[model samples]
Target: MKKFASLLAVALLALAAVSLGTHSKATAADKLPAQVQKIKDTGVLKVGVKQDVPNFGYYDSKSGKYTGMEVEIAKKIADELGVKVEYTAVTSQTREALLDNGQTDLTIATYTINDERKANYSISNPYYYDQVGFLVNKSDNINSPKDLDGKTIGVAQGSTTKTSLEEYAKSNNLHFKYMQLGSFPELAIALRAFRIDAFSVDKSILTGYVSKNNKILDQGFDTMEYGIAAKKSNDQLTNYINGLLAQWRKDGSLQKIYDKYNLDPADADDE
Candidate 1:
C-alpha cells in the first residue's frame, strides 16, 4: 500500500509538470498571430511603411503607386528571403503599435530606434542615418535653425522632430512658436503658403521635399540615425533583418539605394 501511494504521487507530479509546460508554450504561442508565424512558416515577408513621406516612402501621384528608397529596400529584403512581399501603410504614431499588435511584420519607415523604443521593440541594424533638419522658404531669410528663434516653425504631429526641435529651442535659449501640422503634406502646403516660417523634419525628408519644390523651400537644420522596428520578442525576425542589412552595407546596395534618391549615404565609418 505504501509503495502504491508513492507511485501515485509521483505520477500526479509528473502530469502537473507536463500540463504547466504545455500551458506556458501555448501562452507564448498566443502572443503573435499565425500570420506572422506563417511568414516564418511559408517564408513570406510583410513590411509596414508610411505612404506619405516622399523619397523615403510615398505614393507617387503620377504613377499612383508606392515607390521610394525604403520601398526598394523592402523589395530587396523580400527577394533575399525568397518571399512575396506585402506592404501595409502606417502612420508615424501607429507604426510601432501596428508592429506590437502584430498587424505588420516589420516597419521600414524612418523609425528612429531609441532607448525608450528599445524597451518595447527590437530595432534592426541601422540601414540609414538621418538627423532632424529645418525646411524654410528661400526668401524667408532663415539660413539655419538659429534664425528661427522668434519665428513660427511647423512640424508634423507625433514626430521625433517635434521633440528634437523643442529640446533644441530650450537648450539654445531660443523662443520659436511651433505649429503642429497633421502630416508632411500639410506642413509643405503651410510652408509654401507662408503660413509658417519653416518646417522641420528628418534631413533626408527635408532634402526630398526641397528637391521636389526647390522653388519654394530649402534645407536648414540636422538631428539622429533611423532604423527599422520590430517586436522585441521576435528575435528570429530581428536577426534575419540585421543580417540582411549588414549584407547590403557590405555590397554597396544600401549606398546605391540612397544614391538613387540623391541622399548622402552613411556607413559604419560615419559618425
Candidate 2:
C-alpha cells in the first residue's frame, strides 16, 4: 500500500509537468510582436479613428456605431486576427499621441504617410490615396484658391492639409487666414456658422460633407497617401500589417471594402 501511494504521487507530478509544458507551447504561438501579442492575448484590438468624416471613419450618432472606409479596414484587421475591436475616437491632435503613448494599438483614421511622420512612427504601405481639396458653402461662390485670398479657412491642426493648403496659397499668390480647428467636425461647424469661409482638407474628407449647401471643389491638389500607423521601431507589427495589406490588395478584398463605402477603387491602391 505504501509503495502504491508513492507511485501515484510521482505520476501526478509528471502529469502536472506535462500540462504546464502544453500550456507554454500554446502561449508561445501567441508571442508575436509586443503590440500584436498584446492584442492576441487580450483578444481585443484597440483602434484609434476619427469620429467624424463620413465615408472615411464617422461615428453615427443615431446608430451608436462607426461607419466608413477606414472603419471597415479596422474591422477587417480585427476579424482577421480573431479578436474583438474597441474604437477610440481621435482627432488630428490626438491620433499620434494615442499611438505613441500606447493608448491605442493602431490608428487608421485616414492617417497620411509623410517623411516627417515616418521618422517618428511606423506606417503601413499606402492603403488609400487622395488629393487635397477645399470645402466651401455653396453660397460663398468661392470657386478657386485665388478666391480664397483674405478669407478665413479652417484646417485641422497637425494635419498635412494645413501645410498643403498653405503651400497652394503661397504658390498662387493668395493669402488666407487659417483657423486651426481640432477636428473635421469642428471645422464643419465653423464653416456653417460663418466663422470660417471654407474648410481645407483631403478630397475624401470633403466628400463626406457634400450636400446642396456645401460642395468639394472640382480641382484636387497635393496627393495624400493614407496609411495604418503603429509605434516607431515596431517592425513586427508594421510588417504584419504590410503583409496583410499586400494580401488584401491581391485578393480584391481591399477594393471591395472601398466599394462598400461607394468610394473609388482607383483611389484605394498602394503606392
Candidate 3:
C-alpha cells in the first residue's frame, strides 16, 4: 500500500509540472496580441533583413554572420517573443515579396515607411529618421545638390531615392538622369566605373559606402521614415512592434543600438 501511495504521489508531481508549464505558456500568450502570440508559440521568428547597407543590416562574410543595427533590433524582438531568430537576406526589390509569400514574419530591412507601402502592408511607427544624400567621386567636384544637375545618378532598384531626389531637383531647378541598380554595391561599382556620376540614397546608408575616392555630400534632403513591417493582415504584429519601439525609444535602447555602430543619422541640414 505504501508503494502504491509513492507511485501515485510521483504521478501527481508529474501532472503538476505539466500544469505549471502550460499555465506559464498561457500567461505569456495572453500578454501578446494574436499575431505576436503565434510567434511565441512557433519557437522561431523569421525575419527579412538586408545583407548590405553596413550598419543598417549587413552580413559579414568574414564572421559568416549578420551584423548591424537592424539585425540587433530583430534579435531583440525575437527575445521578447522567446523565440530564436532566423534571418533571410532581402534586397529593396525582394523584401515586399518575401512578406507577401509568408517567407518572413517581419521585415527589419531598413524598410522606408511611405504612403504606398503603408497601404499595402502593416508598418509600425517610424523607428529611425534619415534624409536623402548623394555619394560621388571626390574628383567629380559634386559637392552639393546643384552639382548633380544633368548627372547620371545610380540608385538602388525599388528604392525611393530617385523620387526624393527628383523632388529636390525640381524645387532647386536642377535636372538629373538616373540609373537603377539592384544593390548598393552595384551602384558603388557603377560610380567607380564612371558609368554613373553619383550614387544617391539615404545619408546614413551612404556613410557605409564612403571610400577615399568617394564621399557623401554635406547637404541632404527629404527626411525619410524607416519602420518595421508585417503582412497586410498582421495589424496585431505591427501594433506589438510599435509598442516595443515606443518603449525602446523611451528607454534609450534604440539610441544605444545606433551608438554601438557609430551611426549618426543625418538631418535635413546637418552635415
Off by over 4 Å in 3: 1-28, 266-271
TM-score of each: 0.79, 0.84, 0.89
How well is each residue in 62-112 modelled by candidate 2, as lDDT tens digits?
Answer: 999998888888999998788999999998889999998888989999899
Candidate 2 total steric clashes: 0
Residue clash pairs of candidate 2: none
Better of 1 and 2 by lDDT: 2
What TM-score would you give candidate 1 relative to the actual structure?
0.79
Worst 10 residues of 1 by lDDT: 214-223
lDDT of 1 by residue, 29-145 (tens): 565445345575676677898888878889777887778898898888777656788888877878888898878888999887677888888888788876666787777666666
Pairs of residues at least 3 apart in sequence or in different chains that clash in candidate 1: 131-223, 131-224, 132-223, 133-221, 134-221
**Which candidate number has the best lDDT?**
3
Clashes of 3: 0
Residue-wise C-alpha lDDT for candidate 3, range 96-214, written one tens digit per residue: 99999999999998788889999999999988888888899999888887877888989999888888878888988999998999999999999999999999899888888999998
